[model samples]
Target: MAIYSSAVFPPSQLWDYAVKLYNNPEVSAACLRLQDRRGLDVNMLLFSVWVAASGRGRLTDAEMIAGIEAGARWQADVVAPLRHVRRYLKGDIAPADNRLAAELGRGISDSELFAEHMELQFLNEILTRPATGSFGAAERGEAAADNLAAYLGHVTRDISRDDLSDLLQIWQQAFPGADPRLTGLFGPSLQ
Candidate 1:
């Protein structure tokens, strides 16, 4: 989790643009094709961005290790799942209100879990960066696509605490009962 400035990322018209790229049949086909041939997790650039934005997005250090262990893990398999996760975390859509409720078998969707995670991860301070970075359309598109790929990287595993100090305070306040160990994991700034 990173305490990104709202000035760094706010919700915006980019949402539609992102979805448009996401829903493109040809893009989907190309993605799927890439997945089958190169095994999806191909791009290091996507992984780098995802690793930066989402804090290993996985749930645990072990999971992070596993991802690294999965030699040749491309960024493809991770994109869609990351997109799916972002949709819930960013509040663009309610997780419980969607199809996820039917999949997790909890009478609740993973989205609900994610919504809380977003709070614990980034929203606890009542802070949310506007999606307003100076990244150009191409950069934004690249970020979105890579993030989508990262979704897959995280879903099958747990989140890590790589750059988590940026969000630890929020997590401490939002989930006072959170594991002391968990908070410790993201305690100090990397620098």
Candidate 2:
């Protein structure tokens, strides 16, 4: 594993948004499920919400593609590999008395986080220019839903019912104060 220097990259709004959201247990589990089962990019998922929260109403298909492409190579080459190793270490491969494997797993986990931070930074560069349509707080929740659906639509047309549930969990966590009317909007609104 390699060490990553945080001094090289300052945190951005997207990073801050992601950290707070992912810290929620439900959100983190849902995100991991989407990543592991649905082949979704968690950073891209978080980016969509961040953009919406930032008041950018909805992302165009082209914009969604750009976000996906921005960190594709890095995610494939760096982040995924590090995650694979870190997960691989969570087994009985090591002798009972050995702490080396556990310590190595911790290092790999940190490196994975650093790689994700780098990927978020890359995605943030594309958002430097202001988007045309901006929404206020009331609309931001709907905007967040639209942005997530846009990003998910880019991945697959057939979003399963369970996927919507996970997405709803994520959306609710992202916008805890979203109107009750806006709550449970994923099924029909997202489609």
Candidate 3:
């Protein structure tokens, strides 16, 4: 993972924002649910939110696709396998002793997290500069929604409205102060 300091990518503040958002339990749970159930990429989702929060306009479909593609190999070959190992160890499927399994699981989890950080670094490197203007919460939400939708379309042939709603609900919960227009976009179905 690339560590950013005052000397590196002076304008890149999205990584810090992403770290804070990912640290939130609600956001982490939502991201895991999206990944486990919908085959969505958690890194991309975080990237979308980071982009929007940083005042960048919604990423174009091409940009979203590019970001996903950039990290796909590392995600598939490294992170996914680490996650699978960790999850398998947590379940009855693992033949190892409980103590050993738990220890391995913790190590795998740490490795997976490190892999995620690397993906974030790759994403941060490719993102275009934020737009030179202020964006309200509503605009940020719209951009996040658009970017997420594009990612969904790229990953799955048939996009589910329910899944999208679930994502928005979590986003709303995580950011209750977001503009009402954003809440409206997700519709009244989200509670």
Candidate 4:
């Protein structure tokens, strides 16, 4: 299951953004919270952020549906099972050979990452690049908020204040230099 082939899933800006954002401990924690608690697709969440942060603009309903549908299929078929198995491997239920279980867990983790990369590639395919015009931080920030809100709306209407804080963390981390006021724009739907 471990195939170190870049050709399988070529590098993409979405993947790069996801890596950089996820590297931030706060952002990563927020993302996992959204994933574990809300059952939101983290890849789709990242895709929403990338779409706005990269100046591609807000996702249209069609594009949003495309991303959601694609992510759901891949996540259900590949990523989720990999994650389940990886968690199982790390659990006390695994064999007494902790070292071997740890090694196998690493391989599963790599495979999970590869699956995520592929998911990002599929998401990247849904993007429609806008015209060659400047999109300032303000505009990007607003779009990021909208994108995140829209994605969250589709997943669950039960967004809490804590969820908003996590969402804000993700948005701010996505555009750290953006307006401090941008955080207020994230969840008008929830408000």
Candidate 5:
């Protein structure tokens, strides 16, 4: 425990963003549903959001959390989800509907569902790509080439970008060949 604690770093905007990102009705619902059906924790749930968002491009934890909570891919997840969202976006995919979609939108198959996931896929792919800088601030560029690339390595390298998110990575890395989406919500505007 002490060794791990020594490794712990101060929380950044990224961590705060990650918290807010996951702390929402949709993500909460997704976590809840996953928990209800199979029991998940805050950390595991957060990891899921990370994968979904990272697929898009470089995302701060916040952007990823927001996208997941919204049930859209993380803005941090990348541009792919954004593109997906643009496709599924319509006149009424507002916040409440988005939330409802997240709640009621789980595991149902339909053309609408397929299209929505695809949009999110774009979001996921873009998120996993890589953010050039930090939150547009010059002070916090990633440390160096090796470190930066290692970080992006986690962001990329999934068959589906969502798999790049933390939990799936662990699941696949540890267990190999597991279902990333044993559960989650639907709709372009998930949160």
Candidate 6:
């Protein structure tokens, strides 16, 4: 894990914000859909949201790719396996006592949560100062959309416009009636 000598762009508050936003049932479902169907990184998705919310502008394509690479190993080896096990235990695919499965599920959930924290820490290592100068909500939204599109492009060469739109809509709805500064970044109406 990388250690920070000073406060990073996404301080603890923004991390907390990511956690809260991700925990929303709708947001969680959308994240899973993007992850399972589109091969998107949930952490990166949440990171983009954090960046937009914190007035950090948006990640460049290179930054998004680097961030994805930085966290790929831990995410694939630790988080994904834990998640697979937890989900497997939930289904009839695995035969185990209800009590034992439940206990193991809780442990797996904790491990996954810890792994996510580690991912966030890794991402913090590469954090840059928010973009200089003021930007309107629409501009920020466009930046975020572009960042997400770049990420999707990396995952699959043929990125679907509709999929991108759906993903953006999910993120926009995640935090409705947000702060005035952030409202425009989510969608046009909020702007």
TM-score winner: 4
* Better-scoring candidate (TM-score), 4 or 6: 4
Can you tell me which runs of candidate 3 are displaced by over 4 Å? Answer: 1-12, 92-95, 131-133, 173-175, 179-191
What is candidate 3's lDDT per residue for 17-127, written digit by digit as tens? Answer: 777887878778878877888777888888877777668867877778789898788788988898888888998753568888787778787778767777887888786
Off by over 4 Å in 1: 1-19, 41-130, 138-191
Q: Which stretches of candidate 5 lie over 4 Å from their true place?
A: 1-9, 51-191
In model 4, pairs of residues that clash are none
TM-score (C-alpha, index-matched) for candidate 2: 0.87
Residue 7 miss distance in model 5 (angstroms): 16
Residue clash pairs of candidate 6: none
Each model's lDDT = 0.35, 0.81, 0.72, 0.83, 0.36, 0.68
**What tens digits encode model 1's per-residue C-alpha lDDT throughout 1-191?**
22223333445332323234335454445444444544433222123233323322322334333443442332224334444555444453454654553333232234333332332222112222333445543343333333433444554343334213212332333233444242223323333
lDDT of 2: 0.81
Compared with the true structure, what per-residue lDDT tens digits does model 4 show for residues 75-173? 999999999999999878634688888888999999898888888998999876753447887888888888887887777878787888788888888
Task: Compose the digit string of candidate 6's lDDT tens values, residues 140-174.
Answer: 56566556656666777765554655565555664
> Is candidate 2 or 6 superior in TM-score?
2
TM-score of each: 0.24, 0.87, 0.79, 0.89, 0.25, 0.76
Best candidate per lDDT, number? 4
Q: After superposition, how far is residue 92 of candidate 2 from its true place, in Å?
A: 1.5
**Count of clashing pairs, candidate 6:** 0
lDDT (Cα, 0-100) at 78 in candidate 1: 37
Report the backbone clash tally of model 2: 0
How displaced is residue 63 in candidate 6, in Å?
1.7
